[model samples]
Structures are given as C-alpha cells and as structure tokens.
Target: MAINILLTDTSSPLGIGLRNKFESTTFRFVAEHPAELSWRDESQVREYLAEVKPHLVLNTIGWGEGTAIKPDLLADGAECLGRCLAGSSASVLHLSSYRIFHGEGKVSHTEADVPKAASDLSKAFAQAESAILGALPSSLVLRSSWVLSTEGGSLLARLLADFEAGRSTVISEHWRGTPVMVSDVVRAVYAVTQQIIYGANNWGVMHFGSSDVCSESVFAHKIQDMVQAETGRLLQLEAIETETDNSAVLEVRRLRDCFGLQPRSWRQGLRPAVRRWLDRRGLLAEVDSAVVEND
Candidate 1:
C-alpha cells in the first residue's frame, strides 16, 4: 500500500521540491493550499484531514521561501494541526527555521539548546514548535538554516536576479551561516519519513544543514565565480560590514546519528542550482558547452 502524504502548502519551494522528490515513488502525495482552507480553524483542519485520511502530514507553511503567511498565523495554524492530529495514527513533520537562536558564538546550536527568541519572528517560531510538540509529542520538527532554492524569494534567487539585471550584488561580510539546498532538505525528509513509517519512534526537534559554514560574502562570491565560469559573465560583487549579528549555524549530529545521514557540502549543489536558475530565465544558452558538460 502506498503511504498517503498530505502537504500543507504545495506552492512553497520546499513543497515543490518534495512533490518532485516523491512523485515517482510509491508514496501518494496530496496537497492543500492555504487559500483553500482556514488553517487557524481547528474544525476545518479536522474536516480536511478526515477527508484526506493521510498517514503523514508535511507542514511547509512558515516564514521562509517567500511565504506570505505571518509568523503569528503560522503558530496558530500549527496549533490547529497539532490538535487535529492528536490521538490519531497520523504523523506530522513540521519545517522550522534556525533563526530562533540569537547567540553570537561560533558553536553550532544543538537541539538541546533553548531558542533565544531575540526577535518577534523567532518568538513565533519557538511558539509554533512548542504548540506542535505540546499537542503531538511524537511529531517531528526539523529546523534548518539558510535554505537555498532556485524558486521563490530565496537569497540565491535574489542574488541571481541582481546579477542578471547588471547590478552589483551586495552581501554582508559579518553574517555567517550554513547553506542547505532545498533538494537536500527533501532527501532528509524522505529518509526520516521512511523511518517513521517503519515504526521508528525518534521524534522531536532535529537540525540539518551543509557540513561547512561560510560568511555571506564568501557564499556570494562562490555563486559569482560559478556564473562567471559557466557563462563568461563577470558580475560585480560587493561586501558590506553590518553591525547586526545574523549568523545562524545548526548542529546536525542529532539528525546524523538518528538517521545515519551524513551532511554534504553546499558547494556540491551550487553548479546545478545555478544552472537551473539560469536555464529558467533563458540565460543558459550563453553558457559554454564544455562547462555545461563538465558540470
């Protein structure tokens, strides 16, 4: 029997990536957009779940990937979903962000550390996680940092847009983070879901990201270098120092030990991600054939 998977939002990049990942598999994928139903209303959520009868629910409605859902609303929606799934056989996987930690140290934040919640957004994320875990203790909350995607309002998308428009790509020199490709996230989700389906009781907060870390400027320069090497277009890259400490690093030992998943370098996905972005905009025609073949 195919496992029925219900996706909360199919429009987000993560949702799209998940769809692409599981489409050819035996898992049956179904989705409900935020506009179709009121996520804050528990009754509506219950009705929808009962109608779908999904064995697994993937909650992708959150702050990142250019989602318009507000932070407070996200918390409310999660609360409703958790309540609806309580006492049921269904399992949930909530996607969360690592921005909840506001520490300045170089050490990666672990699942054991409490969220600092320095900003309103972070506070809402913490509240959402609390609501989900409080209602469904067996649920999984996967938090990631610096998710890079070719679609939507991701950081890489914005930088690529700037480079395409012949504008200087200004990046921060102080901010540091571990970038994880959306495809990697989808792979993690599939691996974890398979475990859960097979009766693995590992549930709660887990972090996943690239094994390496770098400053915003360095990551941008890498993208710049790829574009230049592939298309022979030199983009102006500028680094600016910022007083605000926006560094976010996630410790992946918990996820690695639990799922036996090893982290891969973010550079491994750089070329393909850039190629997809450029190909979407009809810019890949200018790319060198040799470089494309090598990539």
Candidate 2:
C-alpha cells in the first residue's frame, strides 16, 4: 500500500526537492503550495487534511524572507496543523533550522541541548516546532543546517548564477557549518517515513547535516573549485576576514544511531550537483563563450 504523504510548503527548496525525488515512488506525494491555501486558517487545514487522508504529513514550512512566515501565520498555522494532526493517525514531520540554537562556545548542538533562539526568525521557528511537538508527541522534528540545492534560488544556485553573470562577492570566513544537501534531506525523510510506516516507533527530534564542518569561506571556495573543475570556469570569490565567530554545527548521532544512515560530506556531493545545475540551465558552455570573448 502506498503511503499517502501530504506535504505543506511545497514551494520551499526542500519541498521541491522532496517532490522531485519521491513523486514517482510507491509513496503518494501530494503538495499544497502556501499561495494556494491559507495555512493559518484552522478550518481550511482541517478540510484539506480530511480530503487528503495522508498517513504521513511532512510540514516543511519555515520563516523564509518574502514568504509566509509571519508571527501570526507561524502561530496560527502551526497551531492548526498540530491540532488537526493530533486527531488523525497521520504522523507529522516538521522541518526546523539549526539557527534556533544560538548558544556560543558550542561546536555542535545535540538533541539534549535546549534551543536558545536569538533572532526573530529563529524564535518563530522554535515556537512552531514547539507547537507541533506539543500537539503530536510521536512526531519527528529535524534541525537541519545550511540546506543547499542545485535548483531554484538557493544560496548555492544564486552564487553560481552570480558567477555566471561575472559578479564577484565577499564572503565571511568566521561563519561555520556543515551544509547538508537537499537530496540527502529528502533521503533521510524517506528512510524515517519507511520506519514510521513499518511501526519502528522511534519518534523524536533529531539534527541532520553533512559530516564535514567547514567555514562559509571554505564552502564558497569549494563550490568555486567544483564549478571550475566541472566546467573550466574560474569564478572570483573573495573571502572577507571576520573576528566574530558564527558557528552552527549539528550533532547527527541520533540520525546515525536511529536510521543507520550516514550523510556524505559536501565535498562528496558538490561535483554532481554543480554539473546538474550547469546542465539544467545550459550554463556549462558559458565558460567557453567567455573564454572566446576574452581571446
């Protein structure tokens, strides 16, 4: 039997990646775009869930700029989803950001660490996470760091696009994190869903990210190197020195111990992702054109 999966926030990078990967599978992937539905409306959410009858609800919504992450929306929407899912047998999986843990001096935050959200965005995400967990105690929550995708306006894609357009930017060197690929996130979700469907019954919050923790400057340089290696394009990326440290490392022990899945480092995943991005946009040949023009 195909597990009916209802996904909210389909417009997000993670949601889009999930749909691309799992749409053709035995799992029935149904998405609801935020623009198409009023997420804050409790009655509307209830009606939709009743109609979908999803065995698993993957709520990948978040506080992205220019998106629906307003305080009212976050409060009302989370309350609605949590309230609705509480009555149904469907399991909920809420995607969260690692930025929620704003404590200093900690290299990595684990499941045991309490969230100390510093910014408004992190606070909002924390509140939403709490709402879902409070409503559905058996639900799964994931605090993922630096989610990168080959498609869309993700940071990686945007940087590549900028490089293609001959734009040079300064990146801070003090910030550090292990950027997890969107494909890996989707895979992790799939693995957990399988366990949930098969009655594995290990449900709680967990952190997910690549094993390699590097600074933003290092990650930027790595992407530049990968793109150059893949397409012979030399992108200008300057690293600006910073004295203040901004580190976001997540401990993935639970992810490994629980699901038996170990995510690969960004180095292992960058080449194919860059190639795929260049291929999709036909930007692979742009380097050659630039070379010829320069000549």
Cα RMSD of all models vs. native, in order, equals 2.5, 4.0
Best by TM-score: 1
Once fitted onto the true fold, the runs of candidate 2 whose alpha carbons sit more than 4 angstroms away are: 32-36, 63-76, 103-105, 285-295
Model 2 / residue 62 / CA error / Å: 3.2
Among all windows of 10 consecutive residues in model 1, the one with the lowest summed lDDT is: 61-70
Candidate 1 deviation (Cα RMSD): 2.5
Q: List the global CA lDDT of all models.
A: 0.80, 0.76
Per-residue lDDT over 26-134 for candidate 2, one digit per residue giving the tens place of the 0 to 100 score: 7887874445578877788788888889888888665332233355566567777998888567788888777677545467788888877776766777888888988
Model 1: how far residue 83 lies from native, Å: 1.9
> Model 2 compared with the native: what TM-score?
0.87
